[model samples]
Target: MDKASVDYTLYLVTDSTMIPANKTFLDQVSQAIDNGVTLVQLREKSLLTLDFINRAKETLQLCRKKGIPLIINDRVDVALAVDADGVHVGQDDMPATLVRKLIGPDKILGLSCGIPLEMEKAIEEGVVDYVGFGAMFPTKTKKDIKLDRFGQGPIGIRRLLRTLEKHNSSSERKIKCVAIGGINQSNAAKVLYQLNTPTQKVDGLAVVSCIMAAPDAAKATKDLIQIIHTPAPWTQALTITKEEPQSLENKIKTVTAKSPLVHHITNGVVKNFSANVTLAIGASPIMSEFGDEYEEFASTIDNICLVLNIGTPSPEMMNLFKHALQTYNKYGRMILLDPVACGATQARLNVVKELLNYGQVNVIKGNIGEISGILKLTSTYKQANGNEEEVLMKGVDSIAQLNEDDIISTGKQVSKDFKVVVVISGPINYVIHQDRYKSIPGGHPLMGTVTGTGCSLGSTIGSFIGAQADGRNKDKFDVYEAVIGAVELYNKAGREAAEEAKGSGTFMVKFIDKLFENTHNI
Candidate 1:
């Protein structure tokens, strides 16, 4: 088999033991290949040498019929006996260099890498064609291997990306990299998109149980390929505008016409304000913190959006937040997370981290302190010399005056890491969705004098996102645009409300009224 003819996009490794009692191993492999599996590996660790060779021979004939490559795993003798397309070796198996010597250069050789150092060594040695990197997530198939040896648990997507970078910098020849272990349809998109950087990314995904254990192997393979090929949601850049745009007015109308239900499980202090903000934006509001009601709301509500704020954190509230997040995920509804005062305490940070890890959050609204805390950057404050001087944040407020570059970088990193639109609140609001970022640069200073404004902004954004979910604009729905419109509208209302305000109390009252009045003409 020729190396150029092989497609590594959906690499399938066979585990005969996981095959159903009703089905033969070859039946599953044939089904997977018929659907979209580009490559296959015969991994028979427990079988006798001759038996494994015979199995490989049969599988090779099947793969050759379909024009797909069949590589034997760990057994070079079996691969050589059957004249298999190539052989895949693990770290403890025959040295890749020796395997390369045994098998001619025409065959495809893949090495399983557990960490960056191993990958670097393989590339420097230049013995293999591609690298199989994983235990991307925990898996029963490779349960015997020590996870800690691979770096943090599961060799998470972020770390895998870093390893790729290291490989690129160290090696001149380009080699394909595949993600293996515990990958499935549910997390296929995350594994493909999250483990990607501007300079480097994995060429394909390798699976054990996901393709082998699935009842419908063909459908599973097709679905995984679809996720791998789907365009990333954040590819479009965030664009900013200064004028009173027609798009903003149109989105506001959509919200009013649809009357989307904006559900809130926010802090006790901001419940009233957040609900009013939702209502002001022409969306119905529901405030509930009871975990028991989540299933009811999820089942009943049609045009729904959820807002989760972690300002006032408690164990009970955390449970409710998790419940709502999971329910909304199932319904495919947009969820807005407001990690208010996230940097103020360890408890708040822990809650924010858990929610981010558990759900596919649509948008995350936070202050500078909160966003920086979430990214785990060095906490610093601006000195009198207009420089970012290092200082630990002891309170909730932001002490450092971050420039546009700093804010944009932080926002993009957060958006990429969590696959959500990140909104950092300040006098100049910065909104980032994937690779694009928009900085809306107008708001009254007095808006900062009040509490719950940030929480309210999240509710407002939720309303706009819910309105966009009506399928009429599903393909055109860009969360960055929706959030920019929401921010511009809210900021304009704040400027208008400040014109006739006497003090903080008057400004707060006027701001809510102005938000309601402006929605009519937005």
Candidate 2:
């Protein structure tokens, strides 16, 4: 088989230990290929040389009969004896040059790459046909990943791909990329979609338990193929703007008409205020952090939105946030993340990183300091010198000494990298999507004097997003417009409330009253 013609989509790496009790290993492999798997890799690490060769010969016969390419995992001798189509080896295994020499040029060559240096070496060696980038999530299959660096997930994959571009820009033989380890039905789409950036692309996914360990391998393979071919429900309906956008009043009206359920898993400090703000915006509010109910709530509720605020970063709260994030992603629901004081402590920063790595977030709103912290996580941010500049956090409030231009720029990069709407809230707020951004400059300084105002803004945005879940016309439900409309409405309300209030206490009441007027009109 020609290496270039091989289809890498839905690659199945076989593991006999994970096969179902009712089915034999070859039966699962045969069923998976008959359904949708494009390629197969025979990996029998526990077997003796003779047994491994026998198994590889059998697997190769099944793959050849189905016209699917077969790859041997780290056993070149077995592959040669069986005349397998390819061989895959890890960095710690035999080097790629020797593997290519041993396997010769006609057979395919795959390398396991975990970091940028490994990818750079593969590009320089120019012998690898494809590279598997993983342990995308923590899984029992890959026991070699002991450090956090290897467990960087999708974000790490993006970085490694970007590194490839830097080293091999004009090469005609572009190395195909595959994500392996811990990629299952729930996160397979996310891993594939998140890595599909403008600069980087992941060709396919390599799986073990998703198909091999399934009760019915054929059905599992078919379902995964459908998922790969069909577009994810959450990835569509995005509004991209190159110029100034039109009025989003229609989007606002969608919220009032639908009255979408907005779930808030926020901190204790601003629970009541956030709920009131949600209600005032013509959306139903439910503040529940009980992790047990997330799956039911996400699956049953139509057009539901979750506002996940990390103000109180307890271990319990962090775990709940991860559960809620994954549930929302699985159900194609919108989620607004508020990483409160993300740069204030290392613990909080680590919590936010895990959440971003876990699921797809629709909208992320934070002050300049918090947004700056997110920007630093990506490769887009550059320091003035080699040293890292400190961003001060005054107990959930930002005192980061940055100009408005810097904030807007950071918001743009964060939005582009994460593929979400970013709101950098302050006196002059910026709502940014891929390449476009809208600046709303109306909020009063006194709004910051009140507690929970920023947190309430997240609730308002989430309400608008929930309302955008109109099944009538999913294309018309633009999350970008909803987010921009929400920020504009929230800021306008703050400006109006500040003019009518007597003090900070009165300002909070007036802010709610302003939002309440919108509900009456709706």
Which candidate should be chosen as best, given lDDT against the real structure?
Answer: 2
Off by over 4 Å in 2: 146-150, 241-251, 382-389, 469-475, 519-522
Best by TM-score: 2
TM-score of each: 0.79, 0.94
Model 1 lDDT tens row, 1-522: 567556899999999989987878988998898988989999998999888988898899889888989989988888889888899999889999999999978888999877656766887788788888777766776865433322322224455456567677676766778888777776666567656676777788898788788888888888888878875333322233333335667777777888888888877888888888888878999987777888777777766789888777788887788778767765567788888766666666667766764456788888787887666521111111232224424566776557888878877777766767889888888888777877887678988788877678888888887776322354446667777788888888889989989989999899989988987654
Question: Candidate 1 regions off by >4 Å?
Answer: 48-50, 92-94, 143-155, 162-172, 196-200, 229-251, 288-304, 310-333, 341-360, 374-392, 415-420, 433-438, 441-451, 469-475, 495-508
lDDT for model 1 comes to 0.75
Candidate 2 lDDT over residue span 99-124, tens digit each: 99998999999999887778888998
The deviation in Å at residue 522 for candidate 1 is 6.4
What 10-residue stretch in candidate 2 is worst by lDDT? Answer: 380-389
